[model samples]
Each structure stands twice: as structure tokens, then as C-alpha cells.
Target chain A: VEFGGLRAHCPEAALHAARAAYLAGCQATSNVEAGSRFGIPVSGTMAHSWVMAHMDELTAFARYTAVHGARSILLIDTYDTVAAARLIVSAGLRPAAVRVDSGDLAGLSAAVRAVLDAGSLQETKILVSGDLDEHRVAALVASGAPIDGFGVGTAVTTSADAPSLSGVYKLVAVERESGMVPLAKLSPGKRTVPGEKQVWRVARSGETQRDVVATADELGPPGGVPLLRRLMRRGVPTESAPALDAIRDRCRTAVAALPDGVRRLTDAERFPVELSPDLDRLSRRVGGRDDQGP
Target chain B: VEFGGLRAHCPEAALHAARAAYLAGCQATSNVEAGSRFGIPVSGTMAHSWVMAHMDELTAFARYTAVHGARSILLIDTYDTVAAARLIVSAGLRPAAVRVDSGDLAGLSAAVRAVLDAGSLQETKILVSGDLDEHRVAALVASGAPIDGFGVGTAVTTSADAPSLSGVYKLVAVERESGMVPLAKLSPGKRTVPGEKQVWRVARSGETQRDVVATADELGPPGGVPLLRRLMRRGVPTESAPALDAIRDRCRTAVAALPDGVRRLTDAERFPVELSPDLDRLSRRVGGRDDQGP
Candidate 1:
């Protein structure tokens, strides 16, 4: 994952984006701070500027490999992709990967792969990048391209198509002169449920089946696990936060437990998230729509 | 300017986005860090959560205005735009401005304006904000919406349409045994000019007419002002940086001096930017195509 696009927003965004990508099962990130802070492996190829700085493509490749050795992921699209791969093989420079950052990635990766394989450099992987999103990546994979890795930047970091989330913090309850009173808004297109809530996840054979949003005071349903824990109280943390790696592992496992229909990228089936009987009753009463059935 | 959207990236980006919006002639920012760091005025109405926290919309308005007084900018769209305005006027709450954040802004602004005027709260201004960009702002202005100010966020902060800038730092010249040698990249679709360069802006009648990109050593053309200044030499300071307010003033003045065609929002005429004769000659020579005419 290349989080450089996130840097356009702020330095902290870069770190957060790197962590998010890691938690989403991304194997590596091109952010150094993420590597040092979260232990996510840092990997990236050279920039086009590096190649332009040298006298020729071969010299740039040779110099970079000399310092980084086989770990160097040569950026070959600075001049020509296939030609650079041939030059690397002809000069016996073994790079961990060759990255193509421009042009038709699916077609270019195949051509570059053929050149590398012909030179007995089958171990050198092919990495493709440039305006890659989930749709493009899926299409590339479906096309049977020889891409070993993908370096996604802007689309993932900026979430360009839908740049903002609509999450809001609502006051579910307020302290009155008498006691704590549950609250709810009847605003048009801006309604809210009353009182504090909890989400209980029901799993079957290690796969998540559904989730129930219920009043905080309610007990978990049979065979269901409470997902919310008191992490903070009275302006202080209630417990030590989990390690970054542990959190990442949990995220991976959670995603894996999602049903196939819900996990699909396109036309995804909505995961069941029903309101519990207690919460539903509270919502109707607070909204002043007691006649409506649950 | 509502730079809250920029916070999605990083804290630093929030500061920079606030600065950029301020330099672009935005009067105020919603970001407090920007207010302290850049001395930009901070202004914001209230969140929906604030309204929902109270027992009723009127109570929310009364409580907010009690603290903020006439300076309060009440958010009216939490329930109903016109109804909220009517409520504010009937309750004798004189807010400085009323903000609308949803629906047809053009239609709602006029309706809210009518309500405020009917109640003899003529001094109360109408502010509108949701997903405003330059185009939407211009259209609103053209449609004669009585909008006093705009709270722009995602569009200005993220530059949603074109998010990432394609800027790359290339090695222009190398110090060699003999002397400095200019370098150029012949990469397809990624060519670069040789040597260090400077931009000379030519203005007439206080309006910028054109700019010339020339070799650093070349003399400025007649009536041309050099735009690049050396702030440091060998990593040491050569001069003090200008204060943020002073820089903001300079930016405002510079933008005002642009020709109307170049400043127009839609299908704007491209500002003339040509390479100087000396630089053009050098580019052809460095590209190894010396036979090509300048």
C-alpha cells in the first residue's frame, strides 16, 4: 500500500491510513513510520526521478541493486518497461521485483514477465500500480495478468469517489433534575435511537451470521458474543489498548468470518443488523410513535 | 472555510488547508489549530448533535444564543429550515446568522430569508453549506441566492475531483570533475528540462499577462519580475521567512492581478507559459536531438 496520497491531508492521516490498510489484510505499506510504529513491513520500488538522475537505465538499475541488493524493486516504466527488464537480466542484476507505474498494467505486466522469464529470472516478481482501485485490481486479476503485488495509493487513501463518512455522535441520554432520561431526534432524515446501545455478534462454526443492536443493559442472546467493552470511563482509559499486531490479526479473522455474499465486492449482500426488542421499544416510545408496531 | 474535512488526512494538512483557503480569500476557518497557528479567524455554527442534546429545538437555540448572544449562527435544518427560523424569531432570539446544510440550498435560502425578513430580523444573514465547490458557489451566486458566507469542506480540502498533484523532484544538474552538467530525461510522457530554472512573470496594467521559464543564470526579460527567490544557500538561511499574514496578503494581491480569462472558473483560458530562447536551445541539445529547431 502506498499511502503518499494520504500525506496530502496530513502526516497523521498517513499513519492512520497505513494502519487501516494493514488491518484490512494488506501485507505491506510504503510508509516508513507505519513500519517503525506498527511493525508493518515497508516495501517500495524506486521512483522515476532516481532513474532520471542517472545517465542511463542500466546504470540506475546497477547502482540501485548494488546498495539494496536483491531487495531492490526496480521501477522500470521510467523509460520503457520491457527494455529495462531485459537490461537488468543482461547485466545480471537480481531485483526482488520490477514495478510498472504507468501504461496498460495488465498488458505491460505480461510483456515484462515474458522478458524476465526468458532471461532465467523467474523469481523476480511483477508489481503493478497507478490509479488502481478494487474494480481495476479485480479486472486485472481476472485478465490473468502476471502481477505479484499491487501498490494502491490515491483511491484507497483519499477514498475519492466517496470522500467522507456520515458517522455522527448523538446524545442518546441526558441527565435531568430527576434522573437520566433517554433522548431521540425526530428530525427529518436525521432521526436517532434512544439510550446507550450494544452490538452482539452471533457466529456459527466460526463464521459471523448476524449482529443484534440492543440496549446496553440487556443480556447477550444465546450463542452470541458481546462486541462492545468499556474501554474508557470518567475521562480515563479503562484498560490497556491491544497491541497493533493483535488488533490487525483480529481484524483479519473478523473479515474472514464474513459470509461470501457480504464479502463480495460488487452487489454485496447486506449483513443482518437488527434492533433488539428492548431497543426497538425504547426507540418508538422516545420518537412519540408508540402506535407503530415493531 | 470548513477545514474539518481536511482533518481526515492529518493535523498538518488541516493547518495547511486552512492556510490555503485563507490565502484564497476565505474570511474564516472552522479549525481552531489554524486560528492559533496562522491567526485565521475561527467561526462555526453548531453540530446536529448539539441540537439533539437539548430537550427541544427552541431550547437548543435559546441555550446556544444565551452563551453566544448575537454572534450565534444557528443551524436551522436539523428539523425544518423555515420552521426553525420562525421559532428563533418568535422566541426573540436574534442570531447573527442562520445556516442551512441540506436540501435545495437555493430554494431554502430564499424561504428562510423570507421568514427572517417577515419577522423583522432583517439583520440576520443566511449562510449555506453542504458540499460546496467553486462551481456550486458560482451557480448559487449567479442564481442570486442571498447567501452571506459558505462553509466549504470536503471539496476544497480534498480537491475531490483531482486529488493528487503530479509533482516530482528530478535531478536537474550534477556537479562533476570539470563543472556542472545539465541533465534531462527522455522518458516518454515524462520528459524534463535540463538545468536549474527560474520563472519570470510579466505583468501589464497590474495584471499578469504571461510567464517565462528560463535558465537560472539568464537575465530577466524586460518588464519581467523574477518569481523565485533564494531563501537558503547550502542548507543555511539567507533570509527570514515572511510572516503568515504578510504571505496571505501577498497571495491575495497576486490572485487579484490575474487576467479575467485566466481567473474564470469554467473553461478558463490557460495562462501563457513559454520557455525562454536560451532554455529551449538547451533542452534540445540535452535531449540528444540537437538537429531539432527551437
Candidate 2:
């Protein structure tokens, strides 16, 4: 994934986004800091400016290939996609890939592919990118376009549709003279579940089931695996952090175990998360709704 | 403007956004880094979690006021806004301001204002913030809501509607053995105008009329003011950077000098920007369109 868009926000945000992208199974990233920090492979293609800097497009491709050898990924859409591909092949230059940053990606990729094949440069891959989002990538893949890779930036890094996370920290409990008292906001449209809680993921025979949110002291249901662990205590880490690759592996495994319906990109089925009986009763008591409950 | 949203993007983005906000006349920011870097005042209100951590809303307000004195900006929407305001008055605590983070801001601010005024705490100001954009702030002002200040966050910092800038560095000229030669890209929908250029802002009296883009060596039209200046020479500073306050003043003057139509928040009239005769000729020649032009 190309992380150039990350530089438009904040360094902390870029770091977090790079880590999240890695955890989500992004094979390589264009973010050098992320590569060094997380041990992810760093990869990138040439920019259109590189091609424009030289006297002509063909000369630019040749110079880049001579310096970077077979690792060079020439950007071919500076003037024309098909013409650039033909020129590269005609000059006997073999770049690892050619990226099309604009135009009708699927159609241009097919046309470029044909030209490359005609010149016997079949090994050169076609990469496409330009304001690409999840939906666009899916459509391109569905169209069977001969695209070798996607260099996504803006959509993934900025999260254009949902730009900011709505996560908030709430005080679930406050220590009092009596030890500890559970607290819950009665604010309209902003209520919080009171007290410490634990989430138990119930899976049976390799098929995942629903999650149960119960009070921290409650016992887990049958075949339920606890999902929460103490990461820090009293401003200090409780244990050494897991390696990035190990965390990525766990993320991949967890995502693969999800049901097909819940894993869909669009119209995804909501993953069921139920409140345990004890937790439901506690919620009722804290919310002053116990009069209506047994 | 609260710059918390800037943290969601990148440090460079945050710095640029903070500078832009300062230039656009933002009085203060919640970003301490921005404040120290740009000389903008740092200001912020308490979080809901602060109120939630206390035994009750009244106690939280009392403690916050006791510590911060009249400078305290108490968050009043934890459980109930009006109730919290009334509680503060009844308990004889006078905070500098009360901030409402959610609900119908106009109605709540009016209600809270009435409660504060009736209790003779007329000096206390009212601030409101909750996913507020320019439109919402303008609407609140138009409705004559008794709000004293705004704590905008997401919309301004993230530019929710237009998340990213489409700026590009193009190769406009190349130096060779024969001297400098201008170049222009013929890329579809991404053409460059070619060569160094100067932007001249034409103004009459105190009102900005239009802008003219001319070739660098071309003479400016009568009453035209050059907008670009050299900032660096051979990787060294050409001149000391202007003070932040001076830049802010310049920005204010420039914005105020714009025509009313062009300054409107919605349906803003596009500022006219015409190409000068010499630049037009250069463009035509570089684009190989001289055959069609006089």
C-alpha cells in the first residue's frame, strides 16, 4: 500500500495507520518509517515527475531501468499509456512493471498488456492507481483486468468515507469511601455501560459463534474464549509487546475464522454480541430500569 | 479551532493546518505543539470523562472551578446541560464558561443562558461544539443563540468535505548543454502549462478585481501586484521568514479585500484568473497549438 496520503495528517496517525494496514495483511508499504519500525517490506513505483524530468519518456524509462535494473517500475501514463508501453518494448527496455495513474484503468491495462505481449515483453506487469477506494478495487478485480498490483493511497490512508473514529474514553467506575462504585452516563444518545466487563468469543468446532459481554467477575459460557487481556497496569506495560508480524498473523487468523456473511465488504451481516444475564441485570439496575425487570 | 482532528492525519499536515488556521484568523488552538510553534494561544475545555470520574456533576464543577478559578470552562453536558448549569449556580460556583458538546446547541445554550442569567451569573460565557461545521456555526449565529465561542474540531482540521489537497510539483523546465528548455506534459486531463510564471493580483481601491497569470519575464499590467516571492536560494534562506502575526495580518487583509460574492461561504463566485498575452502565446507554442492561434 502507498502511504503518501498519511503524510497529509500527522506522524502519529501515519504510524498508527501503517501499523493497522500491516495488521490487516498489507504485504508491503511505501512508508519507509513503517517498514523500518514494523519490519514490513518497502516498495514503490516511479512518479510521473521522474519521467517528466528527462528529455523524453523513452529516454527516462531507459535511464531508470539502467540504474535500478529489473527492479524499476516505470510510470507509463505521463503522456499516453499504450504509446509509452509500446515505446518501452520497442526500445528493448524490460522494467519490472508499468503503472497507470489515471484514465480508464481496466481498458488501458488491457490495451497496454496487448502492446507489451506483441513486443514479447510479457513479463512486465501492469499496476494501476488513482483515487482508488475499496469499491473501485473490487470492481477492477471483478472485471478481470490484467492488473498485477494496486498502489492505494488517499482512500485507505484518509478513510475518506469515515474520516474519524468515534471512540471515547468513559469512566465506568469511580473509587469512593465504600471502595468502588459503578457509573454510567444518563445522557441522551450517549449512555455508557457501567463497570468493568469482559468479552468472550464463543466458537465451536472451528466455526465462530456470537460474542458475550459479561461482568468482569463472571464465568465464561461453554466453549467461550476470553478476548480481553491486561496490556498495561499503573502506567507500566504488563508484559512485553508482541512482535508486529505475530500480531499480523493473529489478525489474519481471526479474520479468516469469521463467517462469510460477517466478512463481506458491502451489506455485511452484523456480528452478534449479546449481553450476559448478569451483565443485563447490572445494566438494568444502574440505568434505574430494574422496576420493569424480574 | 480545536486541532485534535489534525492528529488523525500527520505531523506535517498538522503543522500546515495549524499555520493555515492561524492565517485564516483563528484566535486560538487546542494543539499545544501548534501554539508553541506558531504563537497561537492554546485553549481547551474539560472532557466528559473528567466529569464522569467525579462522584457527581456538581462536585466535578466545584472542584474544577476551585482549582482553575474563573478561568475554568466547565463541561456541562455530561448527564444534563441545563441541570448542570443550574447546579453550578445553586452551589454558588462561577466558572468563566460552560461548554455543551451535544444535543440541540441553540436550544440548550439558550436554556443554559437563561438559567445562568436568572442566577445572576451573567458574566459566564456559553460555548458549544459537536461535529460542527461552518454551516452549523453560521446557522447558530443566525439563530441568535447565546453562544459566546465555538470549539470546532473535526470539520475545520480534517476538512471533512475536501480531505486532501491536489497539489503537484511538475517539471516545468530542464537545463541542458544548449541552456534551459521549457517543457509541458500532454498527459490527458493532466496537462502542464509549461515554464516559470508569475501571478499578478489586480486590485482597485481596497477591492481585489482579478488575477493575471503571466510568463516570468513578462511585464505586469497596470495596478497589478506580484503575489509570489523568493523564499530560498541554493538551499539557503533568501530572506528571513515573516513573523506569524504579520502573516496573519496579511491574510486578514487579503481575505477582507476579496469581493463579497467571492467571499460567500456557499455558492461562492469564482475569482477571475486570466492568462496574460505573453503566457498565452507561450502555452500555445508549448502545446503545439501555435498553428491554430494568431
Candidate closest to the true structure, highest lDDT: 1
What would the TM-score be for candidate 1 when compared with the true structure? Answer: 0.84
- For each candidate, report what fraction of the true interface contacts it reproduces: 0.36, 0.46
Give the TM-scores of the predictions, in the order they appear.
Answer: 0.84, 0.90
Cα RMSD of all models vs. native, in order, equals 4.4, 3.7
What tens digits encode model 2's per-residue C-alpha lDDT throughout B191-285?
A: 78877889999999889999999988889989999998789889999889889889989899999999999999899999999999998888778
Q: Which pairs clash in model 1?
A: A10-B10
Candidate 1 interface RMSD to the true structure: 6.2
Candidate 1 residue lDDT tens string, A5-122: 3334556677778888888878888988878987888988787768866657888889998899979999998756788889989999889999998888888999999999999999
Clashes of each: 1, 7
- Against the true two-chain complex, what DockQ does each candidate achieve? 0.30, 0.37
lDDT of each: 0.82, 0.82
- For residues B1-294, write the lDDT of model 1, one tens digit per residue: 564543345567767888888877888899888898878889989887788667678988999998999899999987568899999889988899999888789999999999899999999989998768889999999999889888888777765665565465677787655567787755556678988999999998888999999999999788999999898899999999888778889998998999999999988999999999999989988788342112
